[model samples]
Target: MPDYSLLARQLKALLDTRDWLTNSAQTSAFLMQEIPDLNWAGFYLQRSSEQLTLGPFQGKPACNPIPFSKGVCGAAARTRQTQRIDDVHAVADHIACDSASESELVVPILDTNGALWGVLDLDSPRKARFSEADQAGIEALVEIFCQASDLD
Candidate 1:
């Protein structure tokens, strides 16, 4: 079991630095290495007009751009909440960028004023990869992203 509290704290510290982009990139790399049984760990950012463009990510090449209502990342951004799918195959609108991925966790990153900004997306090659505890942990990390100073 990953120590989510420590992970969240580490993420918060990383997000607090002046270089957010560099930090976010590093964070993605760190998560990709730290988290277990994960095929992907990265971010998708929404910059203008509700468009979610691919950001720093670590894994197999993912879909270039995802709509706000399309995949798990899109749904999380559209709903401004977390989306955890045990089986990607069972998800009606699941986007299979990596056919090996069996599970996914999407955490929406909010701005300071509680507005949708982007999402932290993680995909696992193993089934039932994310649990409620994982959700809670990642949500804490996203909350840190919301309150952190580095988002632009």
Candidate 2:
């Protein structure tokens, strides 16, 4: 029973006057604190032509650069869609940067032109930590982040 409206407002306000890169860091911090049962919360950005570079994140250090066609982050970037994994063990090509993470959710952040820019990734130690409601709420937050922050 998370207050999505309040969360969205906070994210929007934080990003309204901040650069995307800077604001993304703030957003990750916010989510890491707000969300319960999460072991990791962060952003993975498309730095080069076909690479997903690690961005500001909360939790342990993660894999530096994830390829565009590998792992959950890559699948989200390649498909430009949200990836909700209830069980990380079941996901093929799963990256075990953190052995304690049992579940993961990845939401792709798109620019106004619908270009793949980055992704917001969340990991939980509990299996099936994310629900449909969580997905919708996070997706809404992503939209707000896109609208408020400068993609350039």
Candidate 3:
């Protein structure tokens, strides 16, 4: 595992602003650059109660307007929980934005009041790419991100 402590500090430095738009872009880039085996790193904003719109990302083109009833991202958002899937292909509702992606980790982005802001999604071409430690670390990083931004 990469030094999440170090990465946290680095992300703190990189944010440099309270704007969610700017910070989201930077966070996506930071994760893609720092984490290994990642094919996609990005955000999916909860545009409505029913679906998510694509946000800043570093990877190939992605699927848009993901509903709360479908895919790993949807599961995370719907349950307000982190989702770590070992094999995305096994998921019947898995949205194949990138056929190369075999694994996924999604963390729900909620405010201090527990309002649904969005979700941070990471995709890897390798199966079982995200471990327990990775989920904890990335969740921590997402917490940091929410703290440093004005998500309202």
Candidate 4:
């Protein structure tokens, strides 16, 4: 189990006095350091109505400008929901930017007006790496980031 409360606190504190772009990099680094079994941690910004451009991230290189009709990241952004995929291979139209990624989690960032701002994406090499509790916790952390930064 992870200390979600402490993680949220740290994220909030980190974003309390920094620009979103600066904090975006820090958020990725923070999650990469704090979370276990994570191969990638990052963000995608809404560059258009149905397009997501890659933002700050940690891990190997990834796909840029993922369409809304594409993979897990697209699905999350399109539906404005969290897509916690336990197995990347089983999903249809799954984009394998990193062959080492076996599982993925994507959380869409919705602003105060309930509009899509972007997404927080995490990838892991192990199957079934993310749990519902992990999803809830990360959602909270992303919420803090969205609230504190210029991401909205």
Rank the models by TM-score, top first. Answer: 3, 4, 2, 1
User: lDDT tens digits, residues 1-152, model 4?
Assistant: 68999999888887865478888899999999999999999999998979999999999998998999999999999999899999999999998999999999999998778889889999999999999999999999988887787655
lDDT of 3 by residue, 13-115 (tens): 9999999999999999999999999999999999888699999999999999999999999999999999999999999999999999999999999876888
Per-residue accuracy of model 2 over 1-152 as CA lDDT, tens digit each: 68899898887777756478778888889999998999899999987977899999999999979987888988999998899999999988999899999999999988777788889999999999999999999999888878778785
**Prediction-by-prediction clash tally:** 0, 0, 0, 0
Better of 1 and 3 by lDDT: 3
**In model 2, what are the clashing residue pairs, if there are any?**
none
Off by over 4 Å in 4: none
TM-scores of the candidates are 0.90, 0.95, 0.98, 0.95
Q: Candidate 1: what lDDT? A: 0.83
Positional deviation of 102 in candidate 1, in angstroms? Answer: 0.4
What is the C-alpha lDDT profile of model 1 across 41-98, one tens digit per residue? 9989888666688888899999968888688988998998789999999988888999
Q: Which rank order by lDDT, best down to worst?
A: 3, 4, 2, 1
Better of 1 and 4 by TM-score: 4
Q: Which stretches of candidate 3 lie over 4 Å from their true place?
A: none
List residue ranges in candidate 2 displaced over 4 A. none
lDDT of each: 0.83, 0.89, 0.96, 0.91
RMSD, candidate 1, Å? 1.7
